[model samples]
Target chain A: MLDQAFEALKTYDWGTDVAVLAPIDEAVVATSGDSASREQLERRLAAVLAEDVSRDAKDYVCRKLMAIGTAASVPALAALLPSAELSHMARFALERIPAPEAGQALREALASVAGSQKVGVVTSLAGRGENESVAALARLVGDGDPAVARAAVIGLGRIRTPEAARALESAKPADPQAKLEAIDARLACAEALLAAGKKAEALAVYKPLAGPQQPKHVRLGATRGMLAASGKKAD
Target chain B: MGGQHQPTRRRFLQTAGAAAAAPYVITSAALGQGAIPPASERIVMGGIGIGNQGQWDQEAFLGRPDVQYVALCDVRQSVREKYKAKVDERYQNRDCQTYNDYRELLAREDIDAVHVATPDHWHAIQVVEACRQGKDVYCQKPETRTLREGPLLIEAARRFARVVSGGSQRVLEDYTELVNKCWSGELGPIKWINVNVGPLSQLCNLPAEETPADIDWDLWLGPAPWAPYNALRCSGSFATTGGSWRSYVDYSGGGMTDWGAHHFGGATFAVDVREKQPVEIEYIADPQGDHLAFHYDNGVILYHNRPKTENLAVEGTPGQQREAKPVPVYKGEGGIYGDFIHCVKTRERPFRDIELAVNTIAVSHLGTIAYNLRRSLKWDAAAQTFTGDEEANRYLDRARREPWVL
Candidate 1:
């Protein structure tokens, strides 16, 4: 039943209705919180993931795995971490997986994936806001590959902790694109700080960028940031 | 979904798999196509004023196989050729045409519609001309640079019976979705709506710079009175914000109307003010720059640039205000580009149709005029004029350049 739902999932887009997934979706929802039912679904989904089913079908099952997944579902999702076609959906499941094993699986693959793949893993870590991954993120902040380095900068912004803020302030990138990205990331850290109620620390981040001495775009952003932060309370 | 797959939009969807993952993508299906359908239902389009926003508008349509950009136009020779080359390269043919003037592009009988990405000053003239030529228009926001021109554009659109859409697609998301909730009284008679984007544009004062050889300075200054060409004014898109031409009163209405049209476009959906206009407009004091406040006959107020939040804020009755939450920002699925393609096929009026655009632009224009004159103004919405205010009335439209008659 779920396999045919995957077949319909492969054919859908924004232009049409997705109601065809209702029957299998009802089955999944009916089995909610039942470990035995979830295990069976995950096993079936894992088999389909390995088959030549369209990436959309795989993405659909991975999202289902996100809701009812156990540590048992990690291997099927973790196998996709290296695949550009499937990694995003894999991270979608991994990010929501409450089990520590899901995170451990991501950390184990962190060292092996390179280029954009590494960037993807780093992004998943940030999305999970895994504080344990901060040191790993700091090291990649200045990676020689600009895409990797830029992704690391954005990742630090997403992690949004004081440690992440400090890492962003200290990391340096040689490439101009990466340098611009670092500047933007530092501001992102400041926003994260504001969101966390570290008002003075956030203002401190803005002051230097606001000075006339910084680049025009940088100064403009900093000035606006200060103006916006003046009296508004963070919710 | 089989054989002799020519290039239709839905057909392109199945084959173009997972090119890039977007936060906005509801399905990978929006990204790819497997069966290219026949060309009989294909929408042929021309892109006018292919500059910054023009290129952004063009980019959305370029990827769709059903909509083909047969002609490109721009005052700048370099910008037009750059787009021409891009269109040619994408189609793998030299059939894509180029023109310096928008009117010449509108003359092509083969084209079904045109997307207007020109500056504010040129919006009404270009949109009207395209409509007069029986071409549907997808025009950029703040529908007119001046108040008086909005009606004229709408008049032309109605007379031609063209499917005219204002380019603010944010209003297209279920008229965008939250409005339905607002109308359902879920927000309990919204007391005040804060349409916060940013402050209005001030007068242009930058020192003029030498015109570049590649730019046709004369053609770029079309319709609007001549001003010295500064490179800053000529440049487009800064760090993802709207382009530089928006800063000048002579060219665009600055930040206020540019984004105001979009945010208010959403706000009006909630307050249900499509046909009626705000009875009064006033500029409230700000230490940095002035912001606008408009009062409706219904006693609901609309504030521009007064809120801290970027999204439209609906403050309901006391208890509701205490419980209010930010709305999901509306972005049309497939965006305005997709909406236009759908409208072209269905022969339906788009949600952000020209008159709706005129009403929102009028609200922004009222705020802008009040800011410029530094005083409150009484409005006669039916008259489309200010009540007993002569100086404010002068701002309705500027005198067109001698040869470029409106």
Candidate 2:
């Protein structure tokens, strides 16, 4: 039944009867506890990505990889990261694969891809909170592309490590919009720091932004962050 | 981290003085000649995803004398233009702006609040972003698409000090009788309750069709996995059976979350567990069929589609009396809508506060996972993970398509 499902997947396309793929879904569930069976299934699914199958078929495999893929499936998924049409689904699996190799593959794509695809890779790295990619992302905080720069800024904010906070503090964007994004990201980083019990670091980010020169809302956020960091209440 | 505090309205009223100073014409409309409030006193508002529910929410806000509806946004050109025209007609001006992207509307410093009726997938992103932008939110029900989104949404609201109200009128209005019974001590220490909802959202494989000119297909599929543009695939119908985005796993939890927001919300509220989530979910496979039993830390169990049990059915300790407690209701006038407006004016948490709303939807999501894996599971609500179950944990959240992050 699983073999038939794999055979059917080669022809799967959008609008095809999903029932034809039910056995594969069942196989995923059936192999839950059996790591050997799960690994075999993962290998087979990854191999299909290299075959001449429809995009939908590959998409289906990526979704399955999301559930069972490991470092072994990283190479196949990473190969699709350069294709504009396929990068998203590939990242969809790599983003959740819980393996260091998947994060490394995404980090490598940072240089291999460009435009929105690069933005997607930065986002996946941030989503996984990939601390190793912080320096690479920090370098892009002032990228020529506004979208790429803004995404990098927001990604660092989400990462929320002290190093990520420092990256936002050091960024010098030419664009006014990017400047505002940096402030927002810094505020977000401070909030995360305070929550993670790094009061000194949180206060460092909040102190300067709390000044009158900043926007009213940003000042308000910084003031609140400072008070919380100081173990005081915001009246 | 401290108790939720309600800020006074005096500070807002004081800030309005500057804007009030700029106006000079004392025209009839300026004075709010009829029953309407003057422009300076009105809550400046905008609408996102102006489709079925969005339209309904827009009408409710428009009818208010204190709400100044100013903008409409939707990925669909037709929907936004149509709604923009209606707002312009109602206000007797061409001032109502339209945007295909919600970010532009949210960027407006003038818009004090926004009501979002976007699909389940867009709820968390829009709501959190709206909060960050300093706009109070009146987001539609099933406010979270995944379990991971719940805490983040709650934090955004609290961090920004925004008044976010979840759209679930039925929780209080529809289940009034049962809620009264439970809270009034008429049901005597409720042992368990059953909420019948769902046939979990399935994978979508609907064939690709010609992309319509009226819709921004890419924006419509924002954050969700890419799929071909089929009309039925993106249709805003309430149906959860392959007819609309609601039926697809990428977009929704099908009825499990669509109506589950109402049923599970109503059930949890009735049992006074609106602030809590189930700590354990026991999958029951009986001769009749399969169902789920969710155990709360308070020792109250919520059964999802239990065998032969009617919806919102409760089994309480017979004839034992318990102390009555006050049943919470919407503040101010109108129903849920008015409650939101009132909270926006003052800084009180709305009746359907984001935290409570997220708790309500968490039940639906947890049940969806258990049913998918067909096994009992343990949940640590504080940690927001499945204890000792890596496979189950994978379903906590999915990787959103590019440029959209939580």
Candidate 3:
């Protein structure tokens, strides 16, 4: 039944059926409880990318692979990373693979579609929270897309590595939205900086967030950081 | 950091400097990593249902040097004129036009996003249409008046690439951190979450009163089941405190969706109840009780009809009230609004994005449907429908008046 659904989905009008079948197909694979059907779904998903079809088909296939959540499709999905049309789907699928190899695939694919796909690639990497992508993602924080930049801030915030502070500091700004986002990023950066014993610089980084006229979001977010930093200092 | 792909200092300065000037800065560094601008460079804001909530939106944006308050639309001319004066005072140099219809607002290319605080029934249509127009949205909580509206709103947001966040601000509260901690398994596995939502006194089989001269009765009644105007539902001249907004099922979903969105959306997020809808709802009523309970599939329960705890005293009891203190779900002022501004800049999902609110909405709808149907409801979370009840299924989705598709 799962294989039949997968095949039905391939020929299905990528427009209507793919959208309708996405969650249904995923649920079928999820509830099948049969190992053979799972492999069949995975094979169909990985190979569907190679077919000439609509963008929805690619997305449908990616969602299916994600639903399977297995490592076997990693190689097949990874191979499509160089295809710009399919790479975002591949990255999205790879993110759901839930294995070490999936992270490795994302890392290899990261440089392949460097400029146009940073947000998708970085968000996928962050979703995995793999340590290997930390340096790469931190660098992308300084990259040009606001969405990509914010995703990198989130990646650093999630990773909380010492090196990420310099990256955040170099990119920090007074922009309301960026400042709002950085409220936590600043706190995260402070924690990371403090962990490295750069106390004064950490405090300085959070001080302006305490000022009046600062956006309420920035002030609130920064105040929390200051409290945490101050508590650590008192201790 | 050193490679052929690296942006030059001059290029970095230009992009970074531009971000520096924007409300939500999208740095080259952050951009290179993939952060969609929190909002567009041009903040084309629109309003639907420009009454009190609409008036508040004008005040919210009026003098803010950061935003351009582009347009206002409401069903009533009086309400529109009142806010127009307020806005004109704020931006004396710029002319802000008012419209009696919301569809015309959707037609304006200058409008980039909309602030929807319309009546309960109109939410799904106006929001879905705005998304189709490629406008981002800030919609009030209880994203839908009914259960079926959730999937359509979610689909619309996905289809349009718009950022739709619910106005249920409790998701933005600090208490939310505690809730997230609980969900992350730090506060021990939550065996049961009791959500005490209301005082049920809000719904009254009240006698109808006179409709005011300045109101447009029919447009206000758009898509809702037909009912005559009453001062209680119209001017809300007699509601209890801040919740007079609840008197009309046409304008609001009583206390169920109003406070339900705040408490339920926050609790749903905290309890990891964001993905699925409730399996059953059994509303227990006693002649004297102030709250009701909504039960989910995972053994979690939300008690909405009364208050049980003493430390947290909710100022207003749910029924027929107006001018009450803002409910404290998130432990802060400006609950979801501040969080959204923050999320926009940071590009993280705020406490109540459309996706999260959809499930919150579904849960709210289930409670209302079960109450209206006056029976226990067996809901299928995956298919998002009720089992074995055709009459109940009809209430799940609503029919748009005309020309609206999700």
Best-performing candidate as measured by TM-score: 2
lDDT of 3 by residue, B18-65 (tens): 664652555343333243222234244667876756566556644333
DockQ of each: 0.01, 0.42, 0.01
Candidate 2 residue pairs in clash (backbone atoms < 3 Å): A15-B205, A15-B206, A15-B207
RMSD for all candidates, in order, please.
24.8, 3.9, 17.3
TM-score of each: 0.54, 0.94, 0.50
Which digits, one per residue and each the tens of the lDDT, describe model 2 over residues A141-220?
A: 88888788888998898788888998897776765445656776887899888989999989989999787766555676
Off by more than 4 A, model 1: A1-235, B1-37, B172-181, B238-243, B285-291, B307-311, B318-333
Q: How accurate locally is residue B62 in candidate 1, as Cα lDDT from 0 to 100?
A: 82
Each candidate's number of clashing pairs is 10, 3, 54
Rank candidates by TM-score, best first.
Answer: 2, 1, 3
DockQ (model 3, Cα): 0.01
- For lDDT, candidate 2 versus 3, the one ahead is 2
Q: How well is each residue in A1-235 modelled by candidate 3, as lDDT tens digits?
A: 4546656665554124323454545453354456786676566667777777655566556645654656788887787666655666576567656578888877776677654455556656765657778878777766665666776775565455656665666666443334444445555667566667776777787787567755333454456556656763321
- Per-residue lDDT of candidate 2, residues B292-393 (tens digit): 999999899999998899999998887999789999999978899999999999879999999999999999999999988889999999989999987788
Model 2 residue B332 CA deviation (Å) reads 1.6
